[model samples]
Structure formats: structure tokens, C-alpha cells
Target: AQTVTQSQPEMSVQEAETVTLSCTYDTSESDYYLFWYKQPPSRQMILVIRQEAYKQQNATENRFSVNFQKAAKSFSLKISDSQLGDAAMYFCAYTDSGGYQKVTFGIGTKLQVIP
Candidate 1:
């Protein structure tokens, strides 16, 4: 069984500033994929960034980055140069390498960008 937890239910950031959203997961599988997804008011799930459990280096995508600690089972997202468009519902998710195709997601953290 795999589970993802986001302690902060809501967060706010200033324009052009940076904000971090925390997430932690528990899983028995050794190999897996961790991800941060963003859902805006449009109701679309967008892939922000991803980290492979086997990789020690974290993953980054432009303004979006992740701090992945496999030992601690923590995967937090950092959004730099935050924009109004960055305001959305951020979800932390997990998927194992096994044949099972299920992806478990957290309750989500709503991010608000203030001008």
C-alpha cells in the first residue's frame, strides 16, 4: 500500500517570490515514481515535476522543482518566481514500478499567489 500526505492544506506566495509545498509518502515498494501535479481553476491536472526513487538527484522543471528524499520518504515542491498563474491546487502523488497502475494522490494543497 502507498499513501501520500500533504500537511499544509493551503499556502500563499507573493508574485515573483518562492514557496514550498511539503509532502511525504509511505510505501513498501523500493522502486517507484513520485510526482507533483498542479490543478488550476480550469480543473486540469498538469504535471509539474517528477522524481524517481532510484535517483538521488532531485527533479526540476523551470520554475518548478522537487526535493526528494527517498530515505525520509519526503517529496516537497518548490515554485520559484511565482506567478498568478501558479495559483492552483497542488497534489503530491506516488506510483510504484510494479505492474499495478494505480497512482495514489494526496488531499492537495491550494496555492495562492498575491500581487
Candidate 2:
């Protein structure tokens, strides 16, 4: 079993700037996967980034990167060059590769982009 927490309920960033969304999680499992998902008003969970617990290097996708502190049980999302389309609800999630693979999600953080 695991639990995820997003400290920020809502945040706003200026266009072309960067915003960091914080998240922390707790789990007893050693091997697992961490993820940041973005859900627009359309209500679809889109994967923004992912990290493998066994990997030492942080996961990155273009302007999106994850700062994963495995020992501290923290995973934060960094979105660079913020765009209007980036405004949405972001959720931190966890799922083990083995076992039942149940997904545990955070309450989510709403990011607003200022024009």
C-alpha cells in the first residue's frame, strides 16, 4: 500500500516561465513507478512524466522534468516555458510493477497560466 500527497492545491505561473509542482509519497515497496499526470477539463489523465524507482537518473520529457528524491520519498514536476495549454489539474500517482498494480493518486494541483 502507498499514499501520495500534493502540498499545493493551486498555483499560477507566467507564460514562458517555469513552475514546480510538489508531491510526496510513502510506500514500503522497493521497486515501483512514479508518475505525473495532467487532466484537462476534458477529464482525461495524460501522462506527463514517469520515473522508475530503480533508475538513478531523473526522468525528463522535453520541457517537462521530474526531480525524484528516492530516499526522501519525494517527486516533483517541473514545467519549463509554461504555455496556456499547460493549465490543468496535475496528479501524482504510484503503481508497482508487480502485485495487483493498484494506482494511488494525489488530490491533484491545479496550475493556471497567466497570459
On lDDT, the candidate that comes out on top is 2
lDDT of 1 by residue, 1-115 (tens): 7899999999999999999999999999999999999999999899888889999998999998999988899999999999999999999999988877688999999999999
Clashes of each: 0, 0
- Evaluate residue 35 in candidate 2 and report its C-alpha lDDT on the 0 to 100 scale: 96
lDDT of 2: 0.96
What is the clash tally of candidate 1? 0
Prediction 1 global C-alpha lDDT: 0.95
Q: After superposition, how far is residue 5 of candidate 2 from its true place, in Å?
A: 0.5
Which residue segments of model 1 deviate by more than 4 Å?
none
lDDT of 2 by residue, 2-54 (tens): 99999999999999999999999999999999999999988999999999999
Candidate 1's error at 82, in angstroms? 0.3
Worst 10 residues of 1 by lDDT: 94-103
